[model samples]
Target chain A: MSSAPVHAPASNDVIATIRDKALWIRRRSFQMVYEAQLGHPGGDFSAADILATLFFGVLRYDPERPDDPGRDRFVMSKGHCTGAFYSVLAAAGFFSESELSTYMQPLSRLNGHPNRNYLAGVETNTGPLGHGLPVATGIAIAGQIDAAGFRTFVLTGDGELQEGSNWEAALTAGHRRLENLTLIIDRNRLQQGARTEETASLDPLDDKWRAFGWQVEVVDGHDHAQLLEVLSASPRGRGRPLCVIANTFKGKGVSFMHDNVAWHHGVPNKEQYEQAMAELV
Target chain B: MSAAVSVESGFFDCRDSFASTIEALAAADERIVTVVSDSVGSSKLNGFRSKFPERMVNVGIAEQTLVAVGAGLANGGKVPFVSAASCFITGRALEQVKADIVYTNVNVKLIGQSSGVAYGELGPTHHSIEDMAWLRLLNNLTLIVPADPWQTEHAIRAAAAIDGPVFVRVSRMPVPALEHAGAFEVGKAEVLFEGDDAAIIANGTMVHRALAAAKSLAGEGIRARVVNMATVNPLDEAAILSAARTGAIVTVEEHSVRGGLGGAVAEVVTAHDPVPMRIMGFPGFLPTGSAEWLMEHFGLTAAAIADAVRQTISRKR
Candidate 1:
């Protein structure tokens, strides 16, 4: 496996770069979604920063050698956020930035969700909620089996966690003491429906993860410095998995759509798209 | 070839053979592991658990988690055989089986114990007659349904040696050993008895029935070729095409007529050779009964299978 040129920047500097990239990703993602006339823009905006940080800074992956055995595996379990994912991958040099225009078009590799068969950086084809964590657990276990130091990280929605399979995987990850596995819940309160609290209160969500035997950490999902500090921190309680509860707004960086459930799968019209892009600028 | 050589019968459950073979394999290979969904005693994996406690993961009634965890374990460099009730293993954790195991092409062996109506009076919920159909739809999965105890043991050992996703349905119902001591090929079908008149292709608990059906057909002055098709996915197209050349074929299975071994055989025969075929199995929902009674009711017995072969052959003539 060929290693990417590693420039060891100060942690703060890396965070700042990630923040700038996240803004760019949000703007690009919104444009793509608007042009496509179909996509979950709300979740994409909510998760753009986290996706940017992981693809650019946190994950040790070479786009040229996507299937490298030693590469850290990342699964976008909340697959509805494909716009953000595609934007981040383009920025990471997995594919050309021009390819973003092809998203959701006829015969486009960029589908509604991440598909490993078509896309480069995607580890698994995830769309249905609660699937990514289990698949990530498998990759983590595979890493352990080969005694490879590569870690597996999965990004799931706070609402997507409602699926029982995620909890099932959580228990197994904890029981197996898969220290190499990390789960980052994009805890943007709004879901496809109303607010998560109104739909099904996942308040005390951190306790729920801790009770399941995970090393729990909460971070301001939009704050690049805080995100980097929490993400790079090693698993504190040995033999337990790590779960980072990332508090975020549903439609971060977009003023009208932020924390709004209607934007969950809403396609922004020309005016809204212009306004969202202007805000990002 | 003469009619299938019938010997004095003795009843033995294939699960016992599976347990013993798994135990032996685990003793030889440290990488071999078993993950059960709270079915240690039911799956007859008590000995495997006792010998390899660390390797035996009892996930305590969570079927989906059992499969997911097994996939996890397999990912971690362990050859994991996920042991659970076939009904739950295939039905409950189907998506996990698709996503984590088969679609990902992980080297996980899913052992569906007590497949078919093996859980007999426990009701339809416990019956795993749909396992074959459900698993067959997935890609990169090798589906096997062993005929008897000897075949079951061989399948277990062979699966461990192969490095890919496999689902082997082990019958809890007692069956006399079918295959004699021989090498177990993963995808090759065993031509237990051969005749050009007509063909009877069967798998799992139904293989013995097909053999017996051949004998009864012989008594009726008919020579029926009997093929024990253990591997369902990478089907023996050569054998099936040869059987198709026999003018007529009869497929028998312990599952539904839809998408089981019978369906697979018919698919091959119809597409290439277009032979006169009769698919015999549980056609629809079965009423509650003992396993043996259900088999008889569904015309899965030797006499009924022979009758179906005779009928199909007569149609061809």
Candidate 2:
């Protein structure tokens, strides 16, 4: 699954291809989590569309030249969702799809957390919450200083935003007027053990971003067309950074798991895996 | 431009050397940038910020962001010298340092300003005595504690030349630029004085004092070799092994007695060749006083180091 050339306001063919890729991501990522038995499958399913659209329909890079310097960066801040992240990167030709079977195996490249050193297309190491945004802001600031065309996008779990470092980075990105930076919050509303609001309320999240000096865009996270349209827009002259709060369900594709918090990191049993795979089609 | 800054006073602050060197490096290389947590004034980087206003990134007293930005800048083809007070940079954003830079193996230079007890009167909360202990245990991060202006400049340049994580500890305390043989090399100790009776291994504000200790010990017919072990993480095992040949050794630093220069040297000596040793530094937290008072009170002075050397030699055999 090599990267398809991105088209702004993507054509019907492109949207169909992205949907196909997103469905493939759901199937493959869940398969990985099921085999690993120690993975975060719920968040992976929730972020599949956003991750798929970004890689296949929005980002610009050559799979051959991972460090082309001008390539846009997609930082996976919600690191535990490696099931989706590594799947998308593989689809975009970062690594062999066969390697996905090695997930969580000893000495495997696919660790529980994404390691940039271990894998290409992984911009940085992230497992601890609140780290991706600040680092992405720095990368955006660097692009701004050099007048470089490369944009930086970071994806975070809605619950991960509860970490103070993200707010600290949010303040810097807004103050610097980093138009090249975009923060995509996967608002699944479900965290590890409970709902995000139940854990530590973040209801007025869009207004919070606006107050911090960012341009906010609320979108249906699972809608491939909405994600591509909003993410593919030119960042020129935006003045401030963009924050896209992507409203999504924790377990999006399978009916039994949709909006289910219990599936946050629940490994599918043999019977459940068969049912989820059948429903994913 | 190459000479040590403000050498007229015979005492120089390493931070001055740090500022001048970084500014020079940035002037030549467009990729060189500075990131600070509102530490331009304290880091003596006003000159850097003025010269390259667009390149200096002040993240507004946010250490975690300051460090993460440095890693990001490195990813964007820039060599970032992230400057901040050592305590905050190391203690506050330690996880950021570990994950973003060290774990990622990013080419970022972290300038830990006013390290050790340089914040003397501000008390232990401000003191960065635990930085070395915390940082040394982390592999893949280079830790350099330059002794004076000359070493500081060399350390900064050497840090920039490398392509991995580095933490350069700079002090605000004043000290003369001592005579170093040549350019600074990471993980190599510079032997300032030679003797076989015992070896004095020290770095940062304590190196010159160790040399002075050697000078005093000379009059008593006790020749103590002085080694300035700057890069703490790599540990210069060969130099330490050679120093251990003296049968006795004294490791001094401006850090806590545990998990620092002394602790590093002890680890090497015990593994390769066991030797009698004395570790000279603050015991833990110290009573409030000026930097000089704290040094004297905690046996970091020449007289005190010499006494430690004598005691270790007595236990040698």
Clashing pairs in 1: A141-B76, A142-B75, A145-B76
Error of 1 at A175 (Å): 3.7
Query: Mind giving the per-residue lDDT tens digits that candidate 1 earns over A108-153?
Result: 9898777766878877767878888876776676565556777788
Q: Interface RMSD (Å), each candidate? A: 3.1, 0.5
Using lDDT as the measure, the top candidate is 2
Q: Compared with the real two-chain complex, what DockQ does model 1 have?
A: 0.41
Q: Please, what are the lDDT tens digits per residue for candidate 1 over residues B122-203?
A: 7789888888988988857988898877788878887898899899999877777765535679889888887899999998
Pairs in steric clash, model 2: none
Q: Give a tens-digit lDDT track for model 2, residues A3-60.
A: 4454445788778988999999999999999998988889999999999899988899
Candidate 2 — which residues are off by over 4 angstroms?
Answer: A1-7, B1-8
Q: Weakest 10 consecutive residues, lDDT, candidate 2 chain A? A: A1-10
Residue A142 alpha-carbon offset, candidate 1, angstroms: 5.2
Compute DockQ for each candidate against the true complex: 0.41, 0.90
Residue A51 in model 1: shift from native, Å? 1.8
